[model samples]
Target: MMPLSMVASGETVRLIAVRGGRGICFRLAELGLVPGATFQVIQGSGQGPLILAFGETRLALGRGMAHKIYVESFMRGGQECQNN
Candidate 1:
């Protein structure tokens, strides 16, 4: 797993876990960020807040906070998941 801050732009990733305190977790969850949710990176390069698209909503997450979010490729295996 990798931090959300490291995910390449245009990649769709699934949230795995949060490695922060309760307060932080709650705050992020309130913004629609939680385990199992999927998100696409708009901008991320291990610097600054990450600009991510969570469905129709756009979220800007600070680098520190972004680092707390662990994710994996949303696609199963090495292939991209297809839309039905």
Candidate 2:
């Protein structure tokens, strides 16, 4: 899996796992970024900030924070694949 920050705008991805401590993990979870949740990359500042959408909720995540959130890109015709 790759970091959420690496996903391009308009890309859809599935949250796989969080690879950080409790504080970071808990914070992301509270923001609706949980395992198995599908998300889309709405906007990215390219300098760290990114807008992520899951269901109807949107979240702004920094590069450092997003890097800890492991995600796999979703393809329309088949199973999801881990992003590099």
Candidates' RMSD to native: 5.8, 3.6
lDDT tens digits, residue span 1-84, model 2: 677878889999888888888888788778777787788899853775898887888887788887778777777423543422
Candidate 1, residue 21: Cα displacement in angstroms equals 0.6
Candidate that scores best on lDDT: 1
Candidate 2 clashes between residue pairs 3 or more apart in a chain or in different chains? none
The models' CA-based lDDT, in order, is: 0.82, 0.77
> 83 in model 2: Cα distance from truth in Å?
16
Q: Which model scores highest in TM-score?
A: 1
Tell me how many clashing residue pairs each candidate has: 0, 0
